[model samples]
Target: MSFRVGNAFSDPRVTMRQPQPVVLIRGTLNPAHVSAFYATAFPELASWLNLNRIPVSGPPVTLSHIASSTMMEVAAAYPVTVKVPTTQRITMGTLPGGPVASLIVQGSHEYLADGYDHLRAWLGENGYGPGPVSWASYIRLPDEHGDQRACVTELSWPIA
Candidate 1:
């Protein structure tokens, strides 16, 4: 699928954020299965939250803990207004708040690698080292919108 990258990004900036509460389900799966994982995980998370009467504070987000060619450890999460009890599968946690190099990318999932490459290059050029975690907040999802190619994601990489 064809999607625009740099042109859609807001200028990358370093911003300080406060730790936000979240509920998530994490898994280690093959790289090719990540999309399918999100598809299942997000709906389950939403249903769990609704059942618990917890309000979602922001858009659905995915946290990348470890990534490699074969497999990756990732979490599908929703920002919650308050901390909630954890379930057998879902856990309550926080999106660590700190200095992050952040940018907005509008495109299809196929173009995400290119967007991340640009972010990494920018971090290198700007003399910043990326921290352990990185994440993408799905502002507008392809399935939710009329056009499957139209999506907006906010990418954040913690910087040291």
Candidate 2:
């Protein structure tokens, strides 16, 4: 399916989101291993959810805890209607609710850095500082052929 790009990034906004229950897998990964990491994590998460008969509530999200040139500490998560007991590598937790600076970007995942940069600038200009965690909800992912031109990601940073 094809998705159209939107102009949502033109005006970044701060909105309140309710705390959400999610099932996730956390890992420390090199930049080069990010794709492979998610490729494995998502399916495993899905399988566990499916086996447990849990319901998914929204798109997949990546919670970024720490990022640097060499590595990133992140969690790949899926919102769920109900929290489940932790199993093996999968953990259940709630995404914190609060004022979040958000922007939607359309294009490759490579553009996400630019989107974050934009949000950082906007936060500085608007008297806001980033909170402890940031996340990206993947609205529309790349197709099987791995073309990312049409990917849509909502970039969000909790504000302090």
Q: Rate the local accuracy (lDDT) of all candidates.
A: 0.84, 0.85
lDDT tens digits, residues 83-146, model 2? 6889779998777898999888887888788788888889999999998788899999999999
RMSD over all Cα atoms, model 1: 3.3
Full-model lDDT, candidate 2 = 0.85
Total clashing pairs in model 1: 0
Residue pair clashes in candidate 2? none
Instruction: Output the number of the lDDT-best candidate.
Output: 2
For model 2, the superposed segments whose C-alpha errors exceed 4 Å read 1-8, 67-70
Point out where model 1 deviates above 4 Å: 1-7, 67-69, 143-146
TM-score of 2: 0.86
TM-score of 1: 0.88
Worst 10 residues of 2 by lDDT: 1-10
